[model samples]
Target chain A: MYPNNLKYSKEHEWVDLESKKIGITHYAQESLGDVVFVELPEVGAEFEVGDSLGVVESVKAVSDVYSPVSGKVTAVNEALLDNPELINQDPYGEGWIVEMEITGGEEDLLSAEEYERLIKEE
Target chain B: MSQLKRTPLYENHVKAGAKIVDFAGFAMPVQYTGIIEEHNTVRNQAGLFDVSHMGEIEIKGKDAGKFIQKLITNNLEKIEPEKVLYSPVCYEDGGTVDDLLVYCHNWEHFWLVVNASNTEKDLDWFNKHLKDEQVTIENISDNIALLALQGPRAQEILQLLTTFDLNEIRPFRFKSIDIAGVDCLVSRTGYTGEDGFEIYLASDKACFIWETLLEKGKGYGLAPIGLGARDTLRFEAGLPLYGHELSPEITPLEAGLGFFVDLKSEHDFIGRKALEEQRAQGIPRKKVGLEMLERGIPREGYPVQKDGKEIGYITSGSPSPTLGKHLGMALIQSSEAEIGNEVEVIIRNRAVKAQIIKTPFYKKEDK
Candidate 1:
């Protein structure tokens, strides 16, 4: 189940509003079988919504993690540099790839309910 | 939506929670638990693979030996009955048609296991050149099923069902045996370099054998592997996959499988002239191994660069489970293929550093 507190992107990324935590959704991790490498955006890197901030490489495929809100990256989870599988273990918790300070006004990212509907419709 | 063909063991794959994907018009499992897990299982213990999607074609008659010798690059006369020979079937111009295994039963019957995607095309090519009235070719792909039990413990796991001594079957040797009352053709042959057996039987009885083998092999850590680990294992063992290392535009010499090409043999084949010309003039592009020094994983079609110029591209690459490194096989200019050369792989538009290293990232001991 998608977390209720997080804002979702159509590309299967999730963003935590209060803590500004960002990571891929559980569905995204499942679809990309066996995370082997995670390339996170460096701290202080700036990007707009829909910009490719980082990438997640799985055994089967590779996908870019798009930014959900325009922000300057404040932090990156360095643990994933050695162990990329934390994303598979906890996509919403320890798997958080980046923390950013939202710069501009927020974009109309999908709600958890809307994301669920989108997945079901797919 | 339901048009994809399913193998006889489709239900078993679904029951095991396999991730199914469309490959060669067949709904095949790409992974069961995970690629790395299944791959390490095959390296350390044992893993079973549903290779039934491979096409099996039988060439029979008095002229079978002569026709087969003309079709493939390897010398057919060197192959004995109850033995296996790996060869690359080529077009008239020296490009690969398909890399296959020829199981020679006798001068009257020869079985070839070809790539699934090339079945129809290969059959057409075979018939179009069938000038020998004494020979006949039949596509028996739909009637048979293939199972590969591979690993260090493959012999131990396979000995549970059959009364025949598995030790007598040497590498590349095969025999007819009865397993659980069903007749089967068991061979000590596998894509993985590990010691194992490849069994072929009637398609209808595939599920029963699959389930029974898994049940019997439960103690030996036999896991049902998929196409993901199959590619990784074969790649690590330096095997040339049909579509990856060998293609319509790729010759066996450039793919680093020249050992199988019998250029000096007395028999002449379809691509002999072109291959002889290549041997005399020297090969242009050749396959080489690369170990990524950077963080990115090199994938197929990623351009291999040198001094800001495109030299070649990757053919097959993965995070090797056995070696625990991001490795790749690239076909590049033969001039830069020497060991210890440095190259760059263009990953995500950024050039990542990689080092050319010795091939066969993994090989079984004394194997």
Candidate 2:
């Protein structure tokens, strides 16, 4: 499990600010079940808050990954194409779906504690 | 609304941490660990399932055989004592009322296991039709608990506990025997396309049998399975479910179950006339298998399009655990129901390319 140092989205995606690179949290992967396939946005693709950025498909169903904040995708997780199970194994660390360059400061995102509480309510 | 019905194993499922869901007016476990894992366990090893909610009806009398022959599509004359035959009970209009397993114990005693949701309808159909026959139809579903132990190692695990020579029992064969000091009826039948057995016992004895099997088969890798994997496994095997593939609006011939319909028999069945007429005219629609050729996966109720026109709808769809491919069964027009034909499945409002393929998408090799 990843540490509670990053902001999270209600859709289960997490944003960790480490030298400007943002990644998904561990909670996202567990909720998504086994990640058989993932479709991430192309690098350099601009996105606004709530924009559909990608899709994560499990054996049961497919869920869309949305942009938590307005930004441009800097890099996509290329390793997910062959071994999507990495998301289930290491969600917050090596299984991040995309690295985005934040165009603006996080305003609508929930803090680590708030996101944890939100998941509990769910 | 009132709370949904619970089976005898409801508490057991909850104690085992199964995620419960509403199914056919019953609160049942959809998955224990996960659907994919439980499905693979059943395919490679063995898994136990709680199917106590399935409806069982008993018919006994001198005319029981004669009466059931006219009720279902399968020819009763071919079935001997201790043999179970799977068939669909159809309406006079050639539409399927329900798919059931008819167990012939002797010349005068038989049992029919039907879908849980169709219990009331099946009982009424039997009572209405058998009024003139010298038979008694009784709905014994509430009194019986059905447990299915399915997979490759199912027979070996079950044989260890029972005095009955299970190896002598061939497929679709069943016998009443004493196991764990309790008299129960065991059948070598399953829906998962695996070599397995289904046991019917008193509701009080269900927990004992379940616990005994788990304790005895621990070394063989037996896990408690749930309805989630059951659906995916059956879907991968191209088995037709009542509401999805076999419905009141669909005939068995159209649902790719013609093998179970014995038209060659001279016995007059309920839908024999309409079935013969349909056979002569050729089936209007046929159930075909679909494999996704594009990136997206299809789901139930999704529209199947061919050349920009809707030709069919997917009845059951899922990512196959054994094959690792997205597969589905679609009820398509007979003209478009050919293997290798290209079709498009509308998934998430996008048309994804798919191809018509032969059923049983995942084949199990001989053990």
Candidate 3:
């Protein structure tokens, strides 16, 4: 089950509104396989919702990590530089990818129950 | 849209929780547990792979040897019966049709194992060039199933079911033997750059053989590997994959597969003239090994640059599980491809520094 009380995007990204933390969901990490490298956006960068923010390289393929909400990038996770497998080990806690100041309010985001329902439908 | 094809081991892949992807129109397992794990398993211990999708062609005729010599680039006259020879099946323009293994059963019969994606095209090419040739070509891709058990411990695990001496089949040699009392063709050859065997049996018995191997090989740290690890294993060993390293537009010379081409052979073969001409004129571009100087794992189709000018492109690349480093092979101008020369690879729109290194990032220790 996905963590509750977090806004979820259909793209399998989760946001903790209180701390402005964002990371890919457990389902995303599972589907992506073992993460070999993580390329994060520099702090102070601005992006619209659903913008391509960075990339995650796995042993098999490279995938773009998209921003789920519009925001000004405040901090990017540096822990993943040396230990990208943190995303696979703990997708929600130690795997948080970025912190941002919300410039555009949450819109069309789903709750945990809705996100779980959506994934089941897939 | 057409439906994706599945091998006889499709059900087994699903039961094992494999991540299936569409590879060359076939729904194949790209990874099971994980790519890095499965890759290391083959490097240190042993691993099993479902290579049933590879196409096999059987040639039965009095002129089978002559027919083979005319088609592929490698010389078959010197290849002994019961031995296997690797060849780059080339086109008239010197471009590679596919890199395949020719199993010389005898003068009257030969077997060709070709790339699965190139099966239809290869068959068409073979038939088109018959030109009154006295040989019968049969497509056995669907009837035959293949499983490769590879690693240092491969012999011990496979010896459990067969009483025949596995040592009889030397590297690049094959023997028609019985396993678990079932008739099968066993070959002492593998693509993983390790000591192993390739078992070719009836399609119906594929699942049974696969399960049996996994069950018998469990104690030896054998795991079911997928295409993800398969690519990594072959890349680390500097073996060329058909589409990535050799293709219709990529010549064997540029791919560094000339050893298998037999350019100086007396036999007249397809693509011989073109390759000879290319060799005399000096190959413009060639393949070289690359080790990442900066961070970032290089991926295929990415550009390679020298002094900010695009010079080449990565043919095959990944995080080498065995070497524990980011490395790749690139096709660049022969002049710029010298070993130890520095080049930059474009990874995710950023240029990452990489140095050309000696090929074959990993090699198996001699027995």
Cα RMSD, each candidate: 1.2, 2.6, 1.3
Residue B358, candidate 3: alpha-carbon lDDT: 91
Residue range B22-59, candidate 3, lDDT tens digits: 88778899999999999999998999999999999999
Q: Could you tell me the TM-score of candidate 2?
A: 0.91
lDDT of each: 0.91, 0.87, 0.91
Using DockQ as the measure, which candidate wins? 3
Question: Regarding DockQ, does 2 or 3 come out ahead?
Answer: 3
DockQ of 2: 0.44
Candidate 3: residue pairs that collide: none
TM-score of chain B of 1: 0.98
Tens digit of lDDT per residue, candidate 2, span B166-216?
A: 988889999899877888899999989899999999998998999999999
Candidate 1 chain B worst ten-residue window by lDDT: B127-136
Candidate 3 chain B has its poorest 10 consecutive residues by lDDT at B257-266
Q: Distance from true position, residue A76, model 3, in Å? A: 1.9
